[model samples]
Target chain A: MKQKRMQGNADLQKLTDLAQQLRRDTIRMIHHAGSGHIGGALGLADYMAALYGWAMQYDDLDPTDPDRDRIVLSNGHTCAVWYAALARSGLIPLEELATHRRMGSRLQGHPARKAMPEYIETSSGPLGQGFPVANGIALSLRKRVSQGRVYVILGDGELQEGQVWEAFMTSAHYKLDTICAFINYNNIQIDGKVEDIMGIAPLADKIKAFGWHVVEIDGHDTASIVAALSEAASTKGKPTAIIGNTIMAKGVPSMEGDAKWHGNTPNDAETEAALEAVGTNNRFKDFPIANRA
Target chain B: MYSGNKAMRDAFGDALADIGAQDDRIVVLTADLTDAIKVGKFKERFPERFYQMGIKESDMIGTAAGMAIDGQIPFTSTFAVFTTSLANQAIRVNVAYNNANVKIATSHGGVCVGADGATHQAFEDVALMRLIPNMTILVPCDANEAYKATIAAAKMDGPVYLRFGRIPSPVVTGADDPFEIGKARILRDGKDVAIVAMGAMVPAALEAASILAADGIKAKIVDMHTIKPLDENTIIESAKECGCVVTAEEHTVLGGLGGAVAEVLAKNLPTPLRMVGVLDTFGESGEPQEILEKYHLTYSDIVKQVRLVLKQK
Candidate 1:
């Protein structure tokens, strides 16, 4: 029992380290590209780490395997985290992370499936659109009798879009248990705080009322995310909604809880500080300067 | 209720049921309009595959795209207005951008929706659908064509918008007639004028052709159903043969069938042309036939337009 506990703790530590690496890579990619949603990307790093590194079952060699688990970034502005996660997981080349938001690059401002259809299931930029697509994928998986699950990452502000609620009702009504949604509850949107823009208070209660099994956890905690994902997998007869309580800019010290970093990229000095604060030694020591153009 | 007359929506339901039996991957989704959209047959046949989306057109569109991504052929059914206009953004990003294999089967297209008013009638579905990059727009002329188009849409990969009408119009094409995407069917052969039409206006154009024939005018009728990949070859051929063209449809003259044909003619043939359709106005609540006549979408309108074009020629 003690050995088992230690093994679990070691696994948690590995995930935590991976989450920090993802945060570092995400910050560097945004800073190098000169534009991206840094705040949400940073906030969603731990969840991405848990999903790609530990929880989700996907083939690193053949990412487009029909029975592989699918991860859909519904709030596609935080594509930095997705790209970073994909790269870190070896699903995509780590060196290609430099081309984020660049001209003729596969990594666009949003998660465009045209860029990489094999890994990215759908192109998503508009809010609340991804959730329904995830529902459809889950429904299809169910129809095929495939055990594959679909995980959709959405923003807290995206809950304001009526289509998300519609998806919520449909998934639950269809008894799509294979769908597990994670809301990055960072409380900050592009304009301002999510509450100031449009309050989706009583969010967990509302999702539960809609017939989903709801789980609220600390978004920065790797262990809690893994546990919640496991609970979601075990959950039968209904979909799961994990309300991840996360800070806006989670890992970076100066940017944490700051709404201004929601879209703005950090400069050289700020990037150096953020890299140090994220505590990952995998900093870009020889990143190509010519690729910036 | 009458012989050789059935609503395109009913044909869509029957066709879906037939196709669903053969293809297990085929799924039906409706925004709480199963009976109205006539997908009840498919629902009864494949209860598990049929999804009642409960009036949420946007969600339905995204969900259908997702299903498509998972290698399932999802046919989303709803009123034309809600499917095209209400779910425009979702269809653009989720379905069209991703090139997901989603069949948007929209019933009650154009002023044929009648007393449902301007809000319900979709006067600009073809225009809206055509604007999307990877979207295939099919405005079937009658029930037989609608059935064929639905089946073809299922067989074809990527996004397709199949537009049908609420009224029980004439079944112009028989089951044996050839039906292919982006191919125009020339129903009548003539030399004086070419009557190019789509959707509910095909029957009107055919009737107008007969009326012109009685008046010693040879008017050719072409059923240009697929609007996006506009059959420029057939339109140009008809123009070369006829010397003049009159385009007709139940949609607005601004950007529907008439606009598509005029675009092809203006660039390639530059033939004298007259358009017979709604003159950029919303339809009001009335009977289908009453509104169609009020909007000048009847055979008489097509005849008038044909005569005008022939005079210009």
Candidate 2:
């Protein structure tokens, strides 16, 4: 039991290091782009890092392989984190992270499947769409009898769209067991706190009532995310929803839990502070830093 | 109710089932309109391939797009109003934006849905779909054409919107008639005025042509089945010969077949044109014929439009 606990600690440490690296890369990407959702991206660093690091069965060389586990970014504004995950995982060239949201850049403001057809499971920016697409992928996977799972990320506020509930009902009704929804239960959206804007609280109960095997975890904790993902994969007879309770801009202390960082990129001083806080991911050393000195 | 004359949705559903038999990749999704959209045949034949998406049209579109991206040819069937109005953004982003192989096979287009009322009818479906890039819009003439179009849509790829009517008009086209995605079919030969029609309006255009023939006007009748990627070659050729053009449809004159044909004529030939359709008004809950006549979408209305365009020429 001691040895197993140590092994788990080491695993958590590795995931923790990777999450910091991803947050660092995401901060630089947004700082370079001059505009991106920094808060959600930072908040999702842990989820994305754990997903691409050890949880998902992905091959960067065979990115287009249909059998690979799919990541459908339903709430696409946080693509900075997804791009970081991809780049840091060696799925994409780390050097290209600087080209985010630029003219003719593949790393679009929103996740465009056509831009990176091989890696992007589905293109989505509009709220409440990626869930159904994920369900579709799971449906197709079920038909093919392939050992592939679809991991879809959702924002708490995106649940307001009536289509999300429809999608929730669809995955449950169809018994698409291969789908796992990771809900970014950050209270902040564009306007303000999610509850103040429109409460999607009692979110776990809502998803559970929709027939999903629901689990709540600290969305910023890599170990909890991995554990939740494992629990979701093992749960049978229905789809699963991991309600990840998270703070906005989780990595950077000054920005954490702040809604202002949602679409606001960090300035020069803030970039230095953010980089200092979440150091650099050794894998992405070649990635350029854009600080307006 | 008549032999060889079934609703366009029924014909489309039958064709889809047949296509599903031949091609294993064909899957059908309905937003709780199994009987209404007449996709019951496909659902019955391939229960595994069919998905009952409850009453969620938006979710159905996204799901179809999801399946399509995975190399499955998914056909989303529902009433035109729900599919276009409620889920138009879903179609725009998931299918059109992603260029996914999703066939949006919609029924109950226009005011032809009998007593289903204005809320259930659609006059802006074609317009809504046409605005999206990489979208292929097909407005088939009759049941026969709808069947042919549905089969073609399955065989073809990318984002496709095939608008089908709710009423059972005559089976005007042959079963084995040639059908392609963006190609227009010429039904009658004439040089007086080209009557470009789509969906239920084709039969009216044919009758209108016959009426014009009695008065020494050799009107050309065309089944402008494929609205988007409008067959400019055929329209221009017919316009040059006919000197004037009468575009007819059961939809609004704003953007259906009329808008497509007029855009073509206005750009290339500058032919005298008159659009015969609902004049930007909501349809009422009445008999299909009463509503059609009220909206000036009947054969007589086509005749008047034809004469009106001829006078312009």
Candidate 3:
């Protein structure tokens, strides 16, 4: 028991360091692109870092390994952060991280399978559609392969789409224990507060009613996210839904929970502050030294 | 020609059960249409693999796509109209986008849905499915053909839409007959005109050919089942052998087998063609036999179209 706890703590620390690096990558990439969703990316940084760096079992050498567990970004707008995490995880080169939103860049406005194998399982942009696609992946894995997990992340605001519930019901009906669905409950969408824009209150009860094993956690805490995802995987005979409580603009003090920061590019000064907050200056070391820009 | 013995929907279910026994990864999902689409057999044999989505077509397709992603061959069953109209987004996103291994098993296709009328009859099903990219469209002629098509659909890697009619029209093809995707079979050979048909209309075209053969007109007949990746070689060859062509189906004239054949003919040989199908119309609630005659989807209608096209020659 003592040894297991020690190993868990060590994994969390490595994830935390990677999370900080991912944050730095996220800030610099969005700043360079001049157009990208920053708030959700920052908010999801810790949760994504935990999945790629610690939780999900994937191979850096082969993306389409038949036995590898699949992680799908249902809310694909936050590809900026996901790209950074993938780069840090060695799934892609760290230099390519800054090429986000650039013409001919593998990283695009949305997560596309063409960008990098294992980085993106499906191309997603339209809201409320990825949930079912992820479920399909899980169902396939459950039926064909012996042991594989499917993790999908959804924005809280996107839950209002009826298709999410439809997929949720089906997941539970089939008792898809191999799939884990995460909702980044940032409480803020592109327009305004999610409650104000569209009331998604009692979200936990709603998912529980659909027969999913529900877990509530702090989205910014790496350990909490990891534990929740691990627990979801361990639980048998039911699908898992983790309702992550997150601040939309989590890292930067000035931008926390600000709806305006959801999709806007930070200015030079703001970018500097954002980079400093994450405690990284690797942004300036560019061109051949770090050709990702 | 044998008729009124078995519905294609029943054959779909029986074949699915047999396929499930062979391939454990094959799962059968339906929108609360287990009995309606005859998937009860699959449910009885492989209870664990069968799922009923409870009248939600969108969710049914969405979940089936999910199953496909894991390398499972999923057959999502529902009425042709609902799957085509209500669940098109799921089909386009979940199945077509990633090219998931999903088969859309649709029953009650075209005006053969009889007493259920326009609401149930799926005249535009072929049109809707054909418009989507990377979708294999198969219209099985009878129970035997539906059985063969069901097995073929499971073996396909990408998205597929297998259409089956409600009425038991004809069991023209033997159960052991060979069936291959994207290939058209010549049922009868003639020189005056060529009749290209699918679904319940294939046998009608054969009957029309016999009548024309007696008149010494000799109309050629081809079963063009796979509509999307149409057998252009067979269609063009038939058009070359016979200067005129007539395309028949139990669907709307706009975009069914008729439209597919016409599209091929227009681009390839520019043959003079007449289409025998629902003429830009919706079917009404009546007996199955009455609906076929009323909508002009009969052996007589096919013969008339054959004569009309030959006149253009």
- Leading candidate by DockQ: 1
Order candidates by DockQ, high to low. 1, 2, 3
lDDT of 2 by residue, A76-173 (tens): 99998899888878778887788899989899999998899888878888999988998888898888888788999999989998889999999999
Model 1 lDDT per residue over B1-313, tens place? 1238888888888899999999999999999998999999999989989988888999999999999999999999999989888999999999999999999999889887788799998888888888899999999999898888999999999899999988898988888899999999999999999999999899998899888899999988999989978889999999999999998988888888888888998999899989988898988999999998888889999898887878798
Write down the RMSD of all candidates, one decimal each: 2.9, 3.1, 3.6
**TM-score result, candidate 3:** 0.89
- Per-residue alpha-carbon lDDT of candidate 3 for residues A62-129, written as tens digits (9 for 90 to 100): 66776677777878898888888777766777777767888888898898664553556676777777
Model 1 residue B169 distance off true place after TM-score fit, in angstroms = 1.2
In DockQ, how does model 2 score against the reference complex?
A: 0.77
Q: Candidate 3 chain B: worst 10 consecutive residues by lDDT?
A: B1-10
Q: What are the clashing pairs of model 1?
A: none
Better lDDT candidate (2, 3)? 2
Clashing pairs for predicted structure model 3, backbone only = A95-A292, A136-B66, A136-B67, A140-B70, A141-B70
Poorly placed runs, candidate 3 (over 4 Å): A1-7, A10-13, A30-35, A61-67, A98-108, A113-119, A140-147, A230-237, A253-256, A264-277, A281-293, B1-4
Candidate 1 lDDT over residue span A1-293, tens digit each = 00111113327777888888888888888988889999999999889888877677777666677778888899999999899888877777778889999899899999999989988999998999899999999989888888888999999999999989999999999999989999999889888888899899989999999999999999889889988988898899999999999999898889998889988989999999998898745433333345453
Q: Worst ten-residue run, lDDT, model 3 chain A? A: A1-10
